[model samples]
Target: MARMPHTRAAAHPRYEALLAEWNELLRRCQSTAAAQEDAPDPAPYGRELLDRWGEPQRRYHTLDHLSEVLTRTTELAAYAHDPDTVALAAWFHDAVYRPDRSENEQRSADLARRALAEAGVDADRTSEVVRLVLLTVIHDPAPGDADGEVLCDADLAVLAGDPASYAAYAAAVRDEYAFVPDADFRSGRAAVLRQLLDLPHLFRTPYGQDHWERTARRNLTTELELLEA
Candidate 1:
């Protein structure tokens, strides 16, 4: 499989740019009532999520990762039923990430549920956003889940990165789990790679299936071999 260039997620954005992206997405998709005099400002929520992404504990799940998925999602927006809605889910998917925690996705989904409702996102869209955030826990979205397919495919696109980019991704994941011993990390990492390899398909969108699948599998297999070796 021929490798592709890295995702723009690797490109770091200025804090202001990301904040503006969030604010714009929120306002564009916000419920009609969100514009009322009593409505809470959405900017603050965007800033808070950015702050969490910038936290000292994060390595791989940083703002760079967020931008990459957002960019990829935008590129695949043609496949989504509601692009901005799925975009919002990408913002909150790792908003509450903590490397040692197993419940980060749940926590992130809860955060989206509370923040979006308070910020005046419509109930139905908010629910869908929450559902998408949780979907990352299992990168499989059922058939015809257009929005889910876009989000999941964008999130996992890092797997199809060129060798240097994939190496960086692997190194960053190891850095995130720096607390774990070498042998333990090797076993755990190998298990994760194996699980991904076991999946019938690494991507769901037609574009993803055609473009990312082979490269992603090759990258994952190479990394798995290194860990087991």
Candidate 2:
């Protein structure tokens, strides 16, 4: 069957104009946020690779994840002592994510440093950004500074979110390792969940502790049960 062209010319023009306006809004936001003293100009140094593949096929750590983390980090920063550094840390935490690579954090931090240099951000601030990005490793969550703690908390905030969002996050994580066997994936994932449950508190921030600790416990318990079963 032949497809009809969009028949309402005036309506089509209006819709196209609206879409252009919406895109402009997003561009301005990214530019403004990236230009913040704390935020590195996000233009160069690694976007082409992600964009080369196009959307929908994009993996777990897309610009969407960056935006969400940034938004949460901003909120959490209010409670933090070094809000600027925390915000910068959030911007670069996942600046370089590769599911197949084990050195993602290190690589992301490198990219962040380069961006910071290009933006003329201070050397001390760049070093702090690097430290904050690496803290996401979670093998040892001993964040040396308040900014690091806030960034770490923001990154994992989804884990303590509503069950629906938590479930979605779990699925996305599993998808990140889709090549792995289901049993192996479950075992590895359950280990991480167990670690969170065993923590004195998964979140150090008072807000996180209050809002997320209980829900995170419940989710961890449930997920662990599924793994055991």
Candidate 3:
């Protein structure tokens, strides 16, 4: 069995229920989004593709990613200018992840918009969430909106997590892009690690910085050295 991290929230009844509800909602959201999509839905559809990929499955983009994003989103939500929208965006952030596809961001955004529309969330608010979701695809070092910043920080929070979680994340990412030749993956991974190194801090939120900044640096230094090797 994989060694899971110890989290206070993991065993809490409220959190367990939240996880169950979230999974159910995600299933419905994906279906509704596909039905309402402007472009023809992809053959496998995002949900099916995710299911087929299997759990953990040596893939970075999976339920684990979504769960972590949500966990961190909640942690950072209180600091967000628009917590609700940030939370919504987090739920839809990786809805359309495909290792080989470049348009995953747009597809993910569409999915968020469709579900938000069906849920009768405010039109303007949904638009903002969609915009934030799109931002993750082509990340900007500086996020413009509070919700965007909050979501952005939450997505990258893994880099700043504890050493154990950070190590697992690194391994998960390598497994995710396992199909790529090792040399190519190393080069690309190095560039990403370098970018994080250039950042003043990996996380945007003050709380995140305080909690994860130092650890993230430690992880980055180790990762960069390995990549260079």
Candidate 4:
């Protein structure tokens, strides 16, 4: 019976679905925290995050991207040590996105820390969520970091999409940085592609590596060449 935020975006079809999922995830994670008696209802927080993802300033990091990441995280849940926590991390990963900012991941992690603690989640689980959120900054989870692998692989799955889908993702990213000059955008984008390409393996999970690594590599390489050309 939590009151959803008073916002126009709350009327979107998927808003209801995501909110339900968010509430369920909070319950599941909090249950592992031993079920705090007076934990606040999580609907309001979910509404706030949905509103942020639907913000006009965002192009690529929209609600659709959030949905996709959540879906992928669920698919890769079996590989995570704490699946619910990894799913929670996916919720906050891009919750504070702004294409102009370089500290989005850190900021998002801080936000998760404050919000989860306020919602009565335990220190250890909240800390795990924060740590996973920060992992998206480089998408480089260390060896044997199961939760990190799941979250980063889910977030980066867009890179392994079909050619048309990858092209759309690239275009949407450009739209997000519409303020940057073309020359600056190209160089910056190329650097990003290079860094991702240089990773030992773009995905650490067996499922992610078997299904996505080659396609992601090809897509990133093609985009990098286009930028340099």
Candidate 5:
């Protein structure tokens, strides 16, 4: 794997901590892939993943977002049928992001499938990872899809974070779409927020429903009002 420059400094303890966790997740995923079959090493793929997450164009969907999803996955892992798979999904869900692209999720899923296969992961598990990545597009998993529910909920967990963090996230998202004209960006963003608001439940996992639903609604409502204004 090509080494990417480590731009994050130790002064940011949270970024350092998340980097550590990201490394551990990569190690665990590599080990699991190795157990499936003897093939090309997965470490390089993991490095590539980290590099992609560090892309300069990303704002809200950077390594910080990945780390948050991974953290939430850890908290909700107990409810997943295969926690490892869910974690893997979280890692690659936004791996191929592009603010102007409609195929980001599809491309990300394809990347997950190819990388997992190269890592020697079996077809079924790889397929599941792809499915989980695709689920992020609409964030609607089928009923009783425990792993899907966990991954999706974790991905959206930031929506329920504290007001300051949520504000930062919203700003970052706007920055990602900075290429768009202000009025267009506001209209598109408002549409997306309304769609989320229309959902019967913003989160699927029992843990998410119990802990995040109320706050997530409050946050979304607040953002939607601002966007509409």
Candidate 6:
């Protein structure tokens, strides 16, 4: 595939590190895929994926979010069934994001299928990647699904960040929904928060439960209060 022009600068100081990690993950995925079939190199696709994540209209679902998820996936790697697949899912889960649309996850999954197929990834691995991407939609994987649990937890790890960071995340989300009226946004956001709060468990993995459950709950409750006020 042809590479797109790279235009996004590192948003965070650690962005370079994140980029390195992303490249490594893509390399692993492509290597495994290539082992079974004649696959194109993943470097071009990696550049294109980064470019998509850097699109200006994306406020919350930008490269920063991808970096965070990738970081968390690394931290929680031990719990994954196939860490490479989980990492790939993190890269593509929001690759085709649009805050105004409901088909983001489905579209992203479809993109994953096409890209993985073109890269000559075998049916099984590509299907796993697609399944993992779709799991991000409802974030409710069946019990004992280790990779699914790990990916879901990693994607939501931001909710467990410190107060300042959590506030920034909430604000960024609001900015993404800038087109919506305040009342409508508040109502919709509150509903989402409530659903999360009502969940029996937010982070499914043991690591997430041990480290992030409490903080995530606190952050969500605080945000819900602010939204209500």
On a 0 to 100 scale, what is the lDDT of residue 129 in model 2?
75
Tens-digit per-residue lDDT, 1-229, candidate 3: 1123334334433444455545454344333444465423232233332342233333666556666777788888777877767766776777666676678779878877775665545577778888899878644536545676678778887887677888888988888788889999999989988877887656677787788778878889999998897
lDDT, candidate 1, at 126: 93
- The sequence of per-residue lDDT tens digits that candidate 5 reaches over residues 21-73 is 65565456554547666556555666577778878889999887887888899
Q: In candidate 2, residue 74 scores what lDDT? A: 73
Better of 3 and 4 by lDDT: 4
Which parts of model 2 have CA positions greater than 4 angstroms off? 1-58, 139-144
lDDT of each: 0.89, 0.64, 0.67, 0.89, 0.83, 0.86
Sorted by TM-score, highest first, which candidate order results? 4, 1, 6, 5, 2, 3
**Candidates' RMSD to native:** 6.8, 8.6, 8.2, 2.3, 2.8, 2.2
- Model 4's alpha-carbon lDDT is 0.89
Winner by lDDT between candidate 2 and candidate 1: 1
TM-score of each: 0.93, 0.74, 0.74, 0.94, 0.88, 0.91
Better structure of 3 and 6 per lDDT: 6
For model 4, the superposed segments whose C-alpha errors exceed 4 Å read: 1-8, 31-36
Candidates 4 and 6, the one with greater TM-score: 4
Judging by TM-score, tell me the better candidate of 1 and 5. Answer: 1
Where model 3 places Cα greater than 4 Å from the true spot, the runs are: 1-58, 138-144
Decoy 1 TM-score against native:
0.93
Scored by TM-score, the top model is 4
Between candidates 3 and 6, name the one with more favorable TM-score. Answer: 6
Q: In candidate 4, how many Å is residue 223 off?
A: 0.7
Better of 3 and 5 by TM-score: 5
Clashes of each: 1, 0, 0, 0, 0, 0
lDDT of 2: 0.64
lDDT of 2 by residue, 1-229 (tens): 1122222322332334333432332233333435564554333322322232123333556555655676777788767776767666665676556666789789878876776666556677778778888989872456445676688778877777687887887787888788889988888888888777777778887887788778878887887897899
